[model samples]
Target: MYSQLWCRTGLLGLLWLISAGFMSAQTPARTELTVTAMHPAADSPLRLGANFSLRIHYDSPAAFRLRIQGERQGTTIPGITHASPRYGPGAGEAIAWLAFDHLAQLDRILLVAEDAATGHVLTSLALPLTLTWSADAPPGAPAPVWVQELNQHAQLAITREMQAPADGGDDFWVNLFLQAVFLTVPGYIILQIALPWWTRDRWRKAAWAPLIVTVPMFLFVVFASTAGGSNLAPIWLLLVCPPACFYLVFLALFFWLKQKRA
Candidate 1:
């Protein structure tokens, strides 16, 4: 009877292992992908070109193959060479590298991915691509300089026009700051006022307000420095400053009250 019981236990363990393997095999696979042009968004209508990267997300481990089908013109492209999977075992993402330069026309690209084992088409997406030149970076040669020094300066200007700002600075930061201050401050003040106990303790609580604002202000300055006056999103942080300033005043008053209480 003991031998029979031992045999039954071993059989049950093997059956459990087999069931786990079957579940692993049948689990549904899911993935998400974001394909975006790597090129600057504001390149001029004239000198515009196309560059893109495909980010793929998925679950389960499996090999994938990809293809890019598009029209040919005055464009240069480096083909897909390898697959890079990100995230973890159950969920991950893959990025495919692609490059296109000096294209003067509109084009449509269909990106397709397939399962390597069963030859099943796992996913396919179509991307519409277009090119434009820098609004400030004019087409053709720049006008002649008045002096040799002007010519030297012109060369630096020309090179800068070719590059795109990686940091979000141009105008986004400015407007964002404006909006944040105009909208967020009043709301915060009203909320604070509604709390009678908090309002009564404002003097004690206020000192921390400036401390909180100080860090975000430092971050905004750092963000602006890197953006180089190109993108505008950094401006949104300005909206936080007004309320922060108010809180600073409140903090000073709170400190004064604390001294009196002492």
Candidate 2:
């Protein structure tokens, strides 16, 4: 019986060590993303006229490609003239231009992207192709009325409205997180204190008390000082100083009590 118990204890210890290591490794780590482009607009379904340009934006740095597949009905056409690469972590843009001497016909097109290092396809977005231009009036017919002035003015007005704000969602989220952290820590600290008193587990009660009370309060102060207000930082920091110092006193008290009991 003694030998059997010893063997079981050894196996349990090994299992616990493995479990602890796994839990530690599971902590969050940063990740890097690769972005690339796959297809060009010339091969798109719209079969745009030779006079056109395609612009693409990527969220990360990686090898990009633009594939044009189609035929031109008109005389000799000018092929792709220039290619450029942009770099950034969150966003980047690419511009490709196509020019032709005379009007041309086109068929289908595709776009694709892949990781430069691993050669893995990351993202692909197909764009609709379109081309429209006026043909010469019939021999006897009069020219159609064109409204270039009003259209140009309206386009400029609309472009300004579209570029107003990047995104409002992030501001709301940061505010919400700050509020939750504010409310949660105080309650958690209170519960920690109540349980230890109720159960008479001095060590556990003491061990969790300082963390439960201090960590949340510290995070709340950070969020409030940084995200809460405008530029009145010096005053806010001064106002928050007393409460933080008081919390530290409580932490010391708990530690002293725990040590005495132990």
Candidate 3:
């Protein structure tokens, strides 16, 4: 009798396992997106027309859309929004921004991520927040240059969101090309100083080489003396390159014209 009961129990357990496996195999996988952190402490007050960045990590099916919205004591704030025209991510790292035009006792901020193709919201993350006007600052304080630029950029993002084409007016390739030019143009210009050496006969005096090289060396000295000293971006970083690498292209045609005239 005891053996019979034990066999029945084993048979019932095996059947249940088979049914559970069948159900799980038929179910689809779920999507996941998780926010790890945000900037500025709760006590830190945000300024009007300022921008803030959020650090995010997500596992999205495809490239996702991000937007920012705000609330005060659970009440939705109007005329304020955020967008990502270039920085939107398809997978892995993500980004968001905040922009506002007026002061309010903001109790929280909401972040919404969506499927760019279908407009389906992937996830929404909300955090308690506070915004205020500076007590020490005078009324109607003028924004700093950086702040003004950031706000203008945010406004541009908004306009693009409304007016941009289905292709999203993405400029990733263009930006990549420009950045490559900035980094490599200097190297190419320095190569030009060696042209006379390569073209002249062995016995001929390439008199132009020494003088032309001296100017770039002097410019390098000036740049090295002041490299990484400023908080803002500089025209030429302190390096072993001529300052003309950037504007040298503008003078290319004139050099050709002079050669033609000669």
Candidate 4:
């Protein structure tokens, strides 16, 4: 009986050791990755036609692969080379170079890391970027001929006509003529027909009131024809049409009431 008890105890001890080993094998290791630094920092603007280098420092428990992606104005920016996988328990870094060759309204970059073995994403970071023309660049200076040629194949092309010098001589005279006609013709018709009919008894005296109002209207028409024509033409009409319509309605109502009383 004593020999049997000793045998049973040894067998139980062996099973417990095996069970502990299996549990240890099944539990996943807790791996951590932390970003320590980024060169150029965040939200930095770069000059157009300039080359820049970027670096990212990180601490991780195991080896990982990094991917760099860039976008501008909702289009992908090309010419980014991704770095190879780096192994580290303490510190590691990745580097990349970029060239800004095209114009962009808004730019952004993304850094992503994945576990080398499992292909699981370990970390990600996004940075805002901007590309702007150099402030010291001379005005009206043409871009390099190569840059102009490249622009033709670019997703956001910049045409030579867009960069051409502004010629406002013909446009200015045409706008002025249209404005004068709009102002004078309308007032003349109203004074000759509408005013005489509406105020037949005191037509001579009341004519000056409409003419006085015409001065400001003429000024507004001039502004709309000149300044508004470039970009604000539709918006100018939206603003001006409502008030002009309301004024006409009021005048018609006033004439109706006067006729009713008479």
Candidate 5:
């Protein structure tokens, strides 16, 4: 009788241990939250004082909430400008229209996701951004007309007036004309005068080269000027002058080389 009782006790203890082990094996692992995509892209330019869209795609097994925080000089900028479906579970996307009302200088933006139930941080992402005027506007200027038009159609209300008149002004016409003249004059000079006069038969084959190389940049400047604003004089100098000078030097080198060989 004593042996049977001891055997029965051992059997019960073994069964308890087996059940505990099974329970431990059945428990689910904690799911890690991950961000998969963002819009306007990382390291892309953002026009200051404009309403821009930010979209984030993420995956999570548990319920989560997302928040965007913009900081300049370590201080938070307030105003819940825009966002959609801020909280949910599993894999999903969130979008927001953010305005930089107070962005006098460049600001750092943080996208933070947290566990909804426990209020613990799940994941955080940093967006490398530059809050500047579009390649056309002057530094520290308000958002441009095209940008403002974009905002008027968006969820946010942008209040800045369009600086350029609808009828277009003398300054606008003068700038446009100068841009065209600048692009055309250089090409004409290189193709008609400089290349023919300077380079020989063998090197002349590459005469169209300078115009071909610089035309794309010229077109880009024209497009930027039209869409961004009429004030692209500074940008024109930065884009056109250095490359033009370099191309001239390259042509000179080629001429010298060909002449030396001849």
Candidate 6:
């Protein structure tokens, strides 16, 4: 009876050890990412419209990909351009351009790890950055008109294991139509009326019009957005047309009243 009991106990211990080993072998290893080196280092301010490089090391699987994406309204829009290595995680150079403006001056770039086959975001990290731009520096490439139409107010947003947001909609077409009627047509009419009567000397003075209220207000809005939040999609004039028209009319009236008094 004692010999039989010893054989059974030994067999049970062997089975437990084999099961634990199998479970360990079945679990996938977690990947770790490290930025080994980067040019225009984190301390250095980035110039708007400039491209930069980063050298990164990771132990990611062949199925995983590291991507540079821009955050907008809690969702990410495709970044300007991120050319990362196609193969697995190893030391590699990332030459990417982040679209930016005054609002982006203090913003950080977003880097994410994704499972390519599953379209799920597994992890994310923010790359601290700041930007400065000269007037002549090219304007950042604006996101596609339709970008904003994506899940603007999505609750099921960026987090671990969530499927990536879908990127297709009719907002582009709708906005374009509205822009033509309210923005393009009205702008053309205003240009026709003003340009014909204005002298070359007036053009120089008019250039300062934006610097007075428009530029200041735009910058103020950008500052507020940086502190608050920002819309990732850009529909130029869609949001600006109505209010701008009101401002233009009031501006014209204000200038006329001052000139008459003078």
TM-score of each: 0.28, 0.26, 0.42, 0.32, 0.35, 0.42
The TM-score measured for candidate 1 stands at: 0.28
Please give, for residues 1-262, the per-residue lDDT of candidate 5 as tens digits: 9999999999999999999999988975443434443344444455555554565556666676566766667766663455323344556555545655443434666777767665566777766565432544333334445444433433232122133433468868877866775675455445445765677675676665656656676677777777865444335545555555556667777788867997
Per-prediction count of colliding residue pairs?
Answer: 32, 8, 1, 0, 0, 0
Instruction: Give, for candidate 1, the lowest lDDT window spanning 10 residues.
Output: 79-88
Judging by TM-score against the true structure, name the best candidate: 3
* Per-residue lDDT over 1-262 for candidate 1, one digit per residue giving the tens place of the 0 to 100 score: 9999999999999999999999988986653345532223322244333233344445545555455544435243443233322222345444443433443333554566666544455667766665432334345333222223333443554455444343447656766765656765454455444433344455536444454665666567667757654234344545565666566556556655876798
Lowest lDDT 10-mer window, candidate 2?
137-146
Over 1-262, each residue of candidate 3 has an lDDT whose tens digit, in order, gives 9999999999999999999999999874444556554444344565665545555666654556677777887888773555564334444555565656666566777877766765656677787767553434234434344444544665676677666544443565665665775775455456445444444453124324344654666566566557834322233342323444433433444455656897
Candidate 6 lDDT over 7-94, as tens digits, reads: 9999999999999999999986765666655554453544555544445556665455567755544555443554333325443333
Put down candidate 4 lDDT per residue, 36-93, tens digits, no spaces: 4443334445456543445556677666766666777667667434334444445744
Query: Better model by TM-score, 3 or 6?
Result: 3
Better of 2 and 5 by TM-score: 5
- Of candidate 6, the 10-residue stretch with the lowest lDDT total is 148-157
Better of 4 and 5 by TM-score: 5
In Å, residue 193's CA in model 4 sits off its true spot by 90
Q: Comparing 1 and 3 by lDDT, which wins?
A: 3
Please, what is the whole-model Cα lDDT of each candidate in the order they appear? 0.49, 0.45, 0.56, 0.54, 0.57, 0.51
Top candidate when judged by lDDT against the true structure: 5
What's the residue-level lDDT of 86 in candidate 5?
30
The segments of candidate 1 whose C-alpha lies over 4 angstroms from its true place after superposition are 1-27, 35-39, 42-50, 71-89, 101-104, 132-262
Q: What is the lDDT of residue 131 in candidate 6?
A: 41
Model 2 has a clash total of 8
